[model samples]
Every structure is written in C-alpha cells, then in structure tokens.
Target chain A: EPEVTQTPSHQVTQMGQEVILRCVPISNHLYFYWYRQILGQKVEFLVSFYNNEISEKSEIFDDQFSVERPDGSNFTLKIRSTKLEDSAMYFCASRGDPSTNIREKLFFGSGTQLSVL
Target chain B: LAKTTQPISMDSYEGQEVNITCSHNNIATNDYITWYQQFPSQGPRFIIQGYKTKVTNEVASLFIPADRKSSTLSLPRVSLSDTAVYYCLVGGLIKAAGNKLTFGGGTRVLVKP
Candidate 1:
C-alpha cells in the first residue's frame, strides 16, 4: 500500500528559529492536511490544502504557520518563529476522492518529532 | 463538529476480543464515524469508517446503531502488539477544501500476555 512519507523524522531547533516540515503525500491523493499533537494531548488540526490553496485552518494555525505545495507531490508546513510550546509531533495526512461510498480514509505518515528548546 | 466521548483506557489479555465504544450525541446527518489507531510517537492510522449500520473490514468492525449517536470498534483476537491508542472522530466528508478533521481523546488499549 502506498503511504505518506515525512522527512527529517526528528528536528531540534532553538527558540525564534524557522523550521519547515516536509511531506510527500500519496501520489494519487488530492486532499492534504497537517496536524500536531502536544505530548499527552489530543491531535489538533493545523491546516488543509487542496487545489494549491489552503481550504481550512484552525486557530492554532496562526501567523507564524504556513503551508505550501511547492510541487505536485510535496506538501510543507513552515513555522517562522518557534517557541517552547511548539514542541510536538507533526503529522502529514492525505485522502483520495471524497465520495460517500468510498469513505476516503485519511492516510497518515509516521510523523516528525519537532523539539523546540 | 460533533464531540466524541470514549473511555480513557482499557486492558485486555492476549487472544481476547476488544471493543471500544465512542459516543457522539450530536452527530450530524452528513457526519461519519471514523476510527484511527496510534502507537507510541506515531501518527494516527485509519482503521475503519462507517456512516450507519455495521461496516467490517480486515482490521476491525464498526457498529453504528440506527440512531447513529454511538459507534463501537471491535478488534477480534487481539495480541500484545494491538496495544495502542484508538481515536474516534466524527466529521463530514471532505468535499471542499475547508473541511478539517477533529480528533477526540482516544482510548488507550493495552493487551497483555
């Protein structure tokens, strides 16, 4: 089965530094998303991307956060300034066509562990 | 988005069946119940999804009653490797770009030998 792949499985950065997390969603998948989970907290949605534009974003996705689909295959999330609270596991997910009968399940990557000091 | 409630944790012995129930009293007409499993430090993996009635797949079975307010995820013959956090989410289809998923507090299942 094809899977989503994320680069730099672990990242360590100092406060105020910029960080970009990269993901390659399934080739045929259309909808892409970024979610984060603070240690011991529920997974929170960050943003969704489709048709090369952001479809939806949460309050957690503030000014410092941005997403890009620079290429047909790559989806990236960039944080301009990192804070200690930014430490969490960032996940990239994708889904196929969204037909009700198909129930397009979201496939997730193994996730990148972001550690901000 | 409908809020979901589930047990915080559960324990079972190897070879036993495990059923995790999730309650969503305010589920909408277009909402679907989806389940995801997550191991330590990993992203949530899709298990099964159902709108109503029972849906069965190779990995698990999802049972949704007529009311569609609650759903159950049944894992048959679980093993120690089955130990993971299972999340139940209620959301509509991603027809447009703006529809995002909301994950609830998952149920942590520990299968012992």
Candidate 2:
C-alpha cells in the first residue's frame, strides 16, 4: 500500500536555529496535514493544507511555523528559531478524496523526531 | 467535537480477544467513530471506522449502538505484537476546508504471552 514518507527520521538542533521537515504524501492524496506529539502528551494538530494554501491552523501553529507544497509530491514544514519546547515528534499525514461514500482515513508517516537543545 | 472517554490501559493474554470501548455522549448526526493504533515511537495507524451499527474489516471490527453514544473496537486473537495504544476519535465526514482531527489520550493495551 502507498504511504506517507518523511525525511530525517531524527534531528537535533540548537535553540534559535531554523529547521525544515520534509514529507512526501501519497501520490493521489489531495489533503495534507502536520501534527506533533510532545513526549507523554496527546497528538496535536498543527495545520492542514489543500490546493497549495493553508486551510486551517491551530494556535500552536504560530508565526514560527509555516508549511508549503513546494512541488506536486513534496510538502514541507519549516520552523524558524526553534525553542526547547519545540522538541517533539512531527508527523505528516495525507488523505484521499473527501467524498462521503469513500472511507476518509488519514495515513500518517513514521514521523520525524525533533530534538531541540 | 465530542469528548471521548476510555480506559487508561488494559492487559490481555495472547490468543485472547480484546475489546476497547469509547464513550462519546455528545456525538452529532454527522459524526463518525474511527479507531487508530499506534506503537511506540511510531505514528497512529488507521484501523476501522463506522457511523452506526457494526462495521467489520480484515484487521478489526467496530460496533456502534443505536444511540451512538459509545463504540467498541474488537481485536480477535490478539498476540504480543498487538501491544499498542488505541485511539478513538469522533468527527464529521464532510469535506470542509481546513478540517482537522483531534486526538485524545488513547487506551494502552499490553498483550502478554
């Protein structure tokens, strides 16, 4: 089965540094999303992307965060000036058509573990 | 979004059947109940989803009563490898722009030998 793939399975960065996480969603998927889970916490939604623009974002997705569909197959999340609290597992997910008859399931990648020092 | 309540953890022996139930007292007409499983250090994986009644798939089965206030995820003949956290989510199926999913603390299941 086709799946979402994220690069840099693990990344360690210093505070105030910039980091970019890359993901390649399923080829036929039309919706993409970014979610993060802090250690021992529930998964939180960051942002959702469709048609090349952000559809919705959470308070956690503040000015420091941004997402882009740089190409037909690549979706990226960039965090400027990372902080210690930014350390968490970032996941990329995608879903197929939104028709009600079809099963709308979010397929997630293995996730990238980001460590900020 | 409806709030879900589930047990914090459960333990079962290998080859035993496991059932995880989630309570959502405020489920809406458009809402659907979906289940996801996550292993340590990995992302959540979709298991099954249903609006009402019982829906069965190869991996698992979902049972929703007439009231739809609660749902159950049944895993048959579980093994040690089935040890993981299972999440139950309630949301609408409409394709609205900027739609996002909210995940609550999942139930951690440990299957022993």
Which candidate number would show the highest lDDT if scored against the true structure? 2
Whose TM-score is greatest here?
A: 2
On residues A1-117, what C-alpha lDDT tens digit does candidate 2 reach at each position?
A: 898999999999999999999999999989999999999888999999998899989999999999999889999999999999999999999988887454548999999999999
RMSD each, Å: 1.2, 1.0
Scored by lDDT, model 2 comes in at 0.93
A-chain TM-score of every model: 0.96, 0.97
What would the per-residue lDDT of candidate 1 be over residues A22-111, giving only the tens digit for each residue?
999999988999999999999999999889999889999999999999988999999988999999999999988776465647889999
Cα displacement (Å) at residue A71, model 1: 1.1
Weakest 10 consecutive residues of candidate 1 chain A by summed lDDT: A96-105
DockQ of each: 0.73, 0.70
Candidate 2 residue runs with Cα over 4 Å from true position: A100-103
Error of 2 at A42 (Å): 1.1
- TM-scores of all predicted structures: 0.96, 0.97
